[model samples]
Target chain A: MSLLSLRDQLRSGSVTPSGLLDDLAGKIVSRDPEIGAYLSHDLAAAKAEAASVDLSLPLGGIPIAIKDNMNVLGQPCTCGSKFLSENYTSPYDATVIRKLRAAGAIPFGRLNMDEFAMGSATENSALQITRNPHDLDRIPGGSSGGSAAAVASGTAFAALGSDTGGSIRQPASHCGIVGLKPSYGRVSRFGLVAFASSLDQIGPMTQTVEDAALLLGAIAGYDPQDSTSLDRPVPDYLATLNDGVKGLKIGLPKEYFGDGIDPGVRELVMAAANKLAAAGAELVEISLPHTEYAVATYYVIAPAEASSNLSRFDGIRYGHRAANPADLLDLYRRSREEGFGPEVKRRIILGTYVLSSGYHDAYYTKAQKVRTLIRRDFETAFETVDAVLSPVAPSTARKLGESAHDPLREYLSDIFTLAANLAGNCAISVPCGKVGQLPVGVQILGPHFGEAKLLQIAKAVEG
Target chain B: MSKPHIDVRYVANLARLELNEAEVAEFQGQLDAILGYVETISLLDVSGIEPTAYPSPVFDRMRDDEPHESLPLAAVLQNAPDQAQNQIRVPKVVADA
Candidate 1:
């Protein structure tokens, strides 16, 4: 059932949150073994929470899946890695989880992810890889792959997913759902497992733009725990969704459509643009010339930040620890080696190399400079247009093992989506069309804190 | 000018990862290929542009320091590999000291 339909039923008391939880549990029992979307299921606790939910609230006991990277008190947040496998249970609900519970949303389960939220595909997960619900042979995108697949497969009304690079959008694109990465500081990141500190923001993946807006409204606001959370008043996202997109200036970046984008996906994106044009929105051809540098810039900046953030996991404090250690260095080595997956290790090494004393100027500093140019490119483009339009990914979901042989090919899959994260802008991936049954996502990007406007535009396009 | 060879031992030590010989050899090939592609950024004329460290111009959204409630100690230790005295236990570290 659509999340909107579920919400309506939930609000009218036709379906109690407990009943919904039972139904979800049944679905998980039958389907999750094959899909592997869930890392841990708390059916009894979830049912109890659901039973106690006050139906008077907005969410009203909607079943919601949270990505494993986000702390849900008492849940095993493995982050799809062995490093924390049996190491830590969050001491408190993440800011988003608390808000979700406050709005009467039932916490269903913790979903799988790329280890440390560091991969573009769920294949990097040390645990079972999450499969695309639509095509089991293909992968759901990462690092929020499990959340996307769960929502796509009707496991939840909406699922919370974190986006450091293209995690949320790419997975949403692969799963054919609506995923939004709100402006970086718009959502509090107090309890999120940090990947790239500055780039990471938790957002929602849902079957509809309206649901995304509803969830975004509940989870977004200032938090004292998160030093970077924006202190602005949270806007009424649902109220803004109905605003028509007439004369809305949509910028089409020349770079997004170039070279590697698949022909079928491009056709669908252009068709979506044409449909928007037909709906009275004006399309402006724009140039974000520095777009090509986004991938390189993102790799450097994300890794540099990741290297620092991940240092806390040195077989100490919290999370995974090594067995009987002969020495401290051995403990550190074994704990990290056992905990992290290959991709996470690769990123850490790359990041450490870039930040090392001698190489900082050439790699980290240069990449930061490039990042400035990338942000400038967006700033200049935003001046001429209200929002930007692009493809969420260069192509539809590839087979599970297709890009595994070449990591660069895997990284390049995020090319179109990375710029938004790098620019710290809000972007959404809305299913534009299907390519012989595979879904293609048309990405819509808006200025910082323009999530409401972006959702409205996406809703218009959806209509 | 040639691309610098990434010292495998240095990379492994920095990441605190133990790489077997086979894995190291495999990673060397993969890293070289990946770096070759990433090296394209060096070709761009980024001369005067200030490196953009963050996308948004805003900085430091600090909150007031206040005592906040924490989850029960038992609940926090539910998934811990090893714990003692309500604190996480790790091997004695000499390097950090």
Candidate 2:
């Protein structure tokens, strides 16, 4: 059932919370082996929470799937890596998980992801590769691949996925679902295993824009636990969801629509723009001249941040450790070497190299300046346009192992989606149409904390 | 700007990750290519622009200095690879002179 319909049923007492759990449990048993979406799930614990769920609250009786990185008290937060898969368990709830529980939702499963949210595909997971539900041979885009796969396969009603360079939106596009990345600092990052502190934002993946809005509503707010979380009030996303985009101008940045986009994908996105235009929305052609620098800027900044953040997972407390180390340095080296997969190590090396002495001034400092230009580009574009629209990814989901050896190629696939994180704006992926048998999403980028207006246009495009 | 050559062994040591010869050679080649692509940004004239720490404007959130309940020691140490007497155990970092 859809999330809203399930809400209605639970409120009417027509569907018991535990009964919904039982249904999802059965679906997971049947489908999970094929998709490999779940890392682990504690049905007993969910039942315990569901047993006393308050139907009066929003998202009541709903079983929301969690990404592996978010800390939910007592659940295994493996982050799709072998390092934490052995022994680590969350000691406290993440701020988003806390908000979900307060909204009367039962957090259900630990879904698979790219190892420590590092890759463009779930293939980076040391635990398991979560396949795209639409085509089993193709990848569900990562690091939110498991959340996207679970929701796409109907094993999960809705799932929460964090976006750091298109992890959430790209996968949702591949799986024919909706994903939102709230403005940076719009949602609290407390207890989320930090991939890149500045780039990561946890948001929802679901079947519809309304459900995405509903889930975002429950989680977006100020929290003292996260130093970067915004103090602004979260306007009702659902309230403005149905508002048509009349007189609102949407910008199509020329750089994003440039060469290398698959012809079919471009056609679908243009059709979506036409749909918005037909519905009284004005389409504006704008130039974000610095768009080309986004990927390069993101690569330097995200990894530099990730190197610092991931250094916390040394062999000391609450993670995998090498047995019988001769010394402290040996223990730290072996534990991390054995725990982290290749993609993670590559980024760590790159991050460390960029921020290391001699190169720091040229690489890290230069990337940061380019990032400022990227942010200013969006700020300038939004002066005239209410939002920006483009293809969520260059194309639909690619077949598994196609570019496994070329990490740079995979990084390049994130071209359309990386700018939002670099600029710290709200963007969403709502499935617009299909390219061949694969699904494609049209991305809507709004100014920071402009989710109400973004969702308003998303609803129109979703139509 | 000239392409930068990465000292893979030195970088691995700094990152505290142990990599064999095969892994080092492979990653060295790959990292250089990635660095080559990311270096495209160096061509942009950003002389006067300030580097962005975050895309959005945010402040360091402050709270009252009040006592709060902490997680139980058992819960916090439950995932420790080695623990004893409610403390996480690790290899000795210091040596007797």
If scored against the real structure, what TM-score would every candidate get?
0.96, 0.99
How do the residues A108-220 of candidate 1 rate in per-residue lDDT, one tens digit apiece? 88898888998877898898888999899999988899999998887777899999888999899989999999998899898888889879989999999998998899999
True contacts kept of 2: 0.93
Could you tell me which 10 consecutive residues in candidate 2 chain A have the lowest summed lDDT? A230-239
- Residue-level lDDT of model 2, residues A1-463, one tens digit each, is 6788999999998989999999999999999999999999898999999999999899988999999999999889999989999988899999999999999999999899999999888999999878998899999998899999999999999999999999999999999999999999999999999999889999999998999999999999999888899888888888888989999999998998999999999999999999999999999999999988889999999999989989988879878898899999999999988988899999999999999999898899999999888999999999999999999999899999998779899999999999999999999999989987799999999999999999899999888
List candidate 2 segments past 4 Å from native: none
Off by over 4 Å in 1: B67-80, B83-97
Tens digit of per-residue lDDT, candidate 2, span B7-96: 998998999998988889889889999999988987889889998887768565586689999988888788888988889888788998
Any idea how many clashes model 2 has?
0
Q: Which structure among the candidates has the greatest DockQ?
A: 2
RMSD of each: 2.0, 0.9
Can you list each candidate's DockQ? 0.59, 0.86
